[model samples]
Target: MKTFYWLVKRELWEHRGGFFWAPIITGGIFLLLNIMGIITAEVLGASHGIQIGASGALTQVIAEMDSGDMSKVGILLDVAMYAAMGLLIVVLGFVVFFYCLGALYDDRRDRSILFWKSLPISDASTVLSKVVSATVLAPAIAVVVGIIVGMLQLLILAITLSFHGVNVWQLLVLAHPFKVMFNLIGYIPLYVLWALPSVGWLLLCSAWARNKPFLWAVALPVATGLLISWFGIMGLFHLPTRWFWTNIVQRSLFSVFPGTGSLFGGTPHNAPHIDGLHALDLNTTYQLLGSPDLWIGVVAGAALLAGAIWFRRWRDDS
Candidate 1:
């Protein structure tokens, strides 16, 4: 158990740039932009003879917020948080994607695998640590950093509102930043499941590719798709190329978490009208858990991970 902990820790130690610094740097930049926007808005208002300390749209918005309803504030805050999180997700996704692509291959290229293999760790442990780092640890770190950045932005906004005669307390009471942060955190475990197939496949390519894991990881699936399309065109077989691409490959690669709309309780194309703290719906979670595609992907991922372990164990990369 201790060895496994150390293995995971070692992955973190080596890849802290992706798992830690990327999110922090990205979040910090966004927070700075938010502050600058607030300042710019205030300056523009002043130029237009709008008193910062006078009742205006902000006051009206606050008045519309039900004094008894906290969800209104939460939803309002969610908009900003969602925007920030959206960027974070994009940046973090790339970070993890590239991290997974290089996790094993980089070691071999540098001849560090020789040293790692000489350790007491098994191949499974080594590979699984990378998987856990990519899926679980990376997301967890990003979420935590995102939450902090979000809270800071909210604080700055609240202070600005107070100076402008807006009811800062009411805004804070309505926003429920803590609850929003918790809700975001709650999505992480499900995200890991959603991302498994993609991450696992990347690991497989990382472990097995003699060179350029990135090229092999991307090219193989694309080539497979092309081959399938050609076969379908020639009437060699009945292939639902579009369906397979959309439902399987795209789902694995792009759907970081299935039923994320359920988290906000809205359709994918429409934003949810946040009326209250929409706690994660267990039914949606259960639906994902019971999904055939998810399990199929999981099985496939497991097979790929096993292959990765085998490649790591037997292939003489040195």
Candidate 2:
């Protein structure tokens, strides 16, 4: 347990600079864009009011928007939320990819893995540390960045709306930091679970990479899935490649939350269940989690993680 904690802490310490500066960089970019947006909107509103011979009418209209108009405000807030979420996801994915890619490679390059191997830690602990870093620690950092960015986005939105004369008290309340943080806490475990497959692939790559594993890590599975789908033989092996794509792409963490009955509006609609199976109000995630495809993903993930550990334990270092 002590060794495991050290391994985790050591990985964090190495990457702390990147993890710390990422949010600051992202927030800066987002803040700049938002400020420009506010300026553009104000100029547009002023011009619009001038065209109607009401010098300050547009400003007054912005100020006069009441709670009843919260729906409109909500739409704008959603835009900001969506953009920030997208940026956060991209950044998180890249960080995970790079971190895992570097973990074993860096150790091997510096003969640091040998030093650790000489320690009392087992192979399981070595691989498990990487897994935990990818699955838990890396994502946790990204979530924190997301929350900070989200809060800043919310503040910008509120201030922009106020400048336009919109009282965004209710909107601000909905975007409260504590509420968002708690909601994130509730969601993290599920997200980690959902992301396990990718983390497993990353671990596999980190273990196996010689030159450029990211390219292969991404392309190999995609190519395999395509070939299997094209041969129409996935059914023979019970490999539901199509279903895996849908769940990972559509239903996974960092994806949009589907509103009622919508199911992301992208997937083919299943027939409305006339049976008892669909009567319950379980979240759409029920379908994602319960799908045989996701289980297959889990099995594949387990295999990958196991293979990584096996390879690291027995493979020649030369």
Best by TM-score: 1
How far is 25's C-alpha from truth in model 1 (Å)? 0.6
Task: Note the Cα lDDT for every prediction shown.
Answer: 0.74, 0.62
How would you encode candidate 2's per-residue C-alpha lDDT over 1-318 as one tens digit per residue? 988899899878888855556655876787788889878877897877633214456556655777667556554564565456557656766676677667666777677778878888788788888878766776677667777777778888777656645555756754335644554444555555555666666677777877576676667666665776788765886867676455543332222121211233222347354332122223433445544545665676678779888877875675
TM-scores of the models, in the given order?
A: 0.86, 0.74
Q: How much is 24 displaced in model 2, in angstroms?
A: 3.1
Q: Write the per-residue lDDT of candidate 1 for residues 1-318, one digit (tens) a residue.
A: 888889889988999998899999999899888889988998999899877557677687657656555565667776776667777888888888888889989989999888888888889989998888887888889888888888787788788878877877777766656666766777777777767778778888899999989888878777776876777753444646775565455644554432342442123334334343353443334345655666676777788789889998998858
Residue pairs with backbone overlap in model 2: 62-165, 63-165
lDDT of 2: 0.62
Off by over 4 Å in 1: 52-71, 233-239, 255-286
